[model samples]
Structure formats: structure tokens, C-alpha cells
Target: MTTVALVNTASIQERRDAGGMYHHRTNFDKYHPGYFGKVGMRHCHLKRNQSFCPTANLDKLWTLVSEQTRVNAAKDKTGAAPIIDVVLSGYYKVLGKGKLPEQPVTVKAKFFSRRAEEKIKGVGGAWVLVA
Candidate 1:
């Protein structure tokens, strides 16, 4: 018979700063406090705020498409409606919140929630994943 012993060594401690900001520290690393320190790759939107997590809601997308369409229509002399492309390369995730657009729009993003995919398809729109 073989016997194995397991030991738990992981620990987390809450810390408060002079500026009144609360932080957490793990036993492994004393310097960096939270998961924000572990994110190495930088996205376009992340450049603005290190702690910013982007979530693109459907309503926002709809508004963007409408605004673009309006601008394109204004430029057209023959009153032709041009297809609108909503490029969301800056966003990390697209959430299915609020109403979808009446017109079909092509959305390009990194990740999409299940509900978001359904909403886009339901509105005769298409979505593509970008690297």
C-alpha cells in the first residue's frame, strides 16, 4: 500500500493603502496584488485603462450602425443606402443587451456571448471573430 500526503500552502490577505484603496495579496507574489498584473498582452482598448474590461452591448452596436448609415447616406448623392460594418476590434466581449437593429449589420469582434450570437443572427446580421 502507498500513502500520499497533501499540504495546503495558498493564502490570501487583504491590504489597505494610504489612498484608501483596498488590495489583495497572495502568498506567491508579494509585489503584484490582483489578476491585473498577470495580463501581459495589450489590446487597443486596454491602452486607455489597464483595469478596463470592454463589453459591447447590442444597443450600442445598433446606435453605431445607425450613425454610420446616416453619415453614408448624407454623402450619397442618389440617396442610396450603403451597408454598415461595425468593427469592434477594441472590445473583448460582445454582450446581448438591448434591442437589435432593423437593418443587417456585419459585426467584427474578438468574442461573442451565446445570446449575442443568437441576437445577431435573429436580426439577419452576421458576426466574425477577429484575431
Candidate 2:
């Protein structure tokens, strides 16, 4: 079965193919990925923001900052461990959804829930907002 069959190729009238904007009828492989500019609208629906990001809880944070099976902070020459540096880079939203570390653990993040901030301060921990 081929699209170039006689019935398809020998049409009597010279039918104009539907215009290119007729996306619903277009073949999937016919896309001009580079030919189009600004392919989508910002309106008509809410799309996720480029900065929409992951959330961090205090309990999880403690694990990242604490050493194995002990109440001490993980070693870092400049600060906390490298694994936890992403939160400090202002991409994570921290929440007080889990236990706090025994020792004060300084953290830097873009956003912190009210409870998280309070808990951090309450438990002798410090938090700073990243720019």
C-alpha cells in the first residue's frame, strides 16, 4: 500500500493541498523545526515557569548536612557538603516538613516556608536567602 497509487496520483482536478497552518492534517515528519519562530503563545494556558523547581524539607536537609550516624555537620572546606549546594544556589524551596539537625546548619536557598524558617532559627540553625 503506497500513497503514490494511481487513485492518489491521477486526481482529475488540481486540488490545492490545505494550507500549512492545517496542523491537524499534516504529516508528523513534515515539521520545519527551524523555519518557525516563537512556536507557542504565553497565553491561553499556564505553562510551568523556567524557574519552577524542587522542594527541600528540613529532615532531608539534615541528612544532606549531617555526617553518617552522628550529630555533626558534613565536612566542607567552604561550607556544607557539595551534594547540598544546589539548595544554596537559590533553586530549591525549603520546608519544615522533617526533623532538624542537632547542630546548627547554615543553609542558603531562594525560598523557605515560614515554618521552615522558624524551625531553623528555633533549632539554633541559620538560613540565608540567596539573591
Candidate 3:
């Protein structure tokens, strides 16, 4: 079994600037505090903002997953909506706040996001931590 995670490029950068969180900020202007001597995070989204992440080529990572999983949602309906396994950098205060499903889903690959974990767990799905 395999899984897929989708993260917008801008979200990664947003997480780095918010002192490890992604909220209460607009842009990455000025040296963000608490980033001293530590390697700064990188942006995977093509655009510099989250609003444009959808247009970014997140396919780079998805393509690899498709090859390994043998489950291409693009071709098959059963495997189409691959459980949104991976977590993006930012959180959806409203969306993530919704109730989770109620079922056990054997996690195959890795995922990020505390909220996502909680959502998955609420639905009785397993949340396998990864780096």
C-alpha cells in the first residue's frame, strides 16, 4: 500500500517565518525571529504566496508517488482520491476544525500536520509520523 501528501510551496515558507507556526503573518519580509543560526525552511510552491499554490507544480512529488504506489488516481477511480495522507505546512483553521471520519485507514506513507493527525485519528484512521 502507498499514500500521497500534497503541500503548497508557499506554505512551507510560511511555516518557517511564523516561529514554527503558520499564522498571524502576511509576508516573509524582515528577518523572522527565532531563525537564528538555524537552516531556514524552503518553499516548494511555484509562487511566493499560498493563494497561488494551486497553480504550482506540486506534481513533482505526486508523480513519484504514483509510480511507486501503482495507484494513479488520474487513471483509476477506486484509487483516485488517495487519502490526503501528507500534511501541508499551514493549517485550515475552519476546514481542519471540522469533524473527522470514523474508520481505520492503514497509513502507507508519511504525513505532516498536527491538525491532520487529529482529524485522521478522530476518524479512527492511523496517523503514522514521518520526517
Candidate 4:
């Protein structure tokens, strides 16, 4: 009780405070914290597009073709093939992963790979750029 009696003149509760808990920590940078850099006019907002672009592949499209079309090759029911439309938003590019789609499907995306574009068009499908 003698230690508290010394500094308890102003306020008895104030003596318990051990302030500056984060003083001079090694990892804590005051000026330059995490994700640092002057972005644009306000140094807070970004001037250019900083979002990452998502991608799509042709092998994935084949799964849909197999689902909506007559996939039973043994039955030989390949009459009046249905052209399926695949709408992919937030995807910048469509890649052909060394595999071609068996059926025609209209792909709506921003960009298409050389192989993917060729393969889609080669099968009488369409690639509509949604820019």
C-alpha cells in the first residue's frame, strides 16, 4: 500500500496505467505500414485497375456441352445439336487446355486464347467479347 501512497495524489486509479504498450516494436512501422505506396491523386485511391483477372478454360466448357447435348455416342443420336450459351462474367480470358470441346457452345467473355478461339470457331461455335 506504501507504493500506491506515493503517486496517488492526482488520482488513485491513474497509477495503474502502463501506457505506450506498443512503443518501439520492431515489426510495427508507423510511416510505412502494410500495403504501402502512393496510389493516385489522394494517395489513398488507385488510379489504375488493381484487381486481378480471372480465367476460364475450354476443358471446363466441355463438361457443360456433355450435359446439355446428346452425349451418348453409342446410341448414335447426333441429330440437331443444341448450341449452348455459356455466360462467364468477371473472367478476362478463356484458355484452351490442350483439349477441344466436342460440341458447339457460344462463349461470352472478355478475351479468348488463340487456341480456344480457333477451337470454338472451328466447331461452329461463337466467341462474343463482352467488353
| Candidate 2 lDDT tens digits, 73-94 | 4333344422344365444788
Q: What clash count goes with each model?
A: 0, 0, 3, 0
Candidate achieving higher lDDT, 3 or 4: 4
Q: On a 0 to 100 scale, what is the lDDT of residue 2 in model 2?
A: 60
How do the residues 1-131 of candidate 1 rate in per-residue lDDT, one tens digit apiece?
Answer: 99886744342222223222333334324554563445667565445555565777877775655566756655666634344344443566778888874555567776788998899888666888876
Select the stronger candidate by lDDT from 2 and 3. Answer: 2
TM, every model: 0.46, 0.50, 0.24, 0.51
True lDDT of residue 4, candidate 3 = 78
How much does candidate 1 score in TM-score?
A: 0.46
- Which regions of candidate 2 fall more than 4 Å away from where they truly are? 1-51, 65-91
Output the better candidate (2/3) by TM-score: 2
Ranking by lDDT: 2, 1, 4, 3
> Which residue pairs does candidate 1 place in steric collision?
none
Cα error of candidate 2 at position 56, Å = 0.8
For residues 39-129, what per-residue lDDT tens digits would candidate 4 score against the true structure?
5575666656656567778777655446425464324444444543444334577888766646555677767888988888887668888
The ten-residue window of minimal lDDT in model 4 covers: 18-27
Give me the displacement of residue 118 in model 1, in angstroms. Answer: 0.3
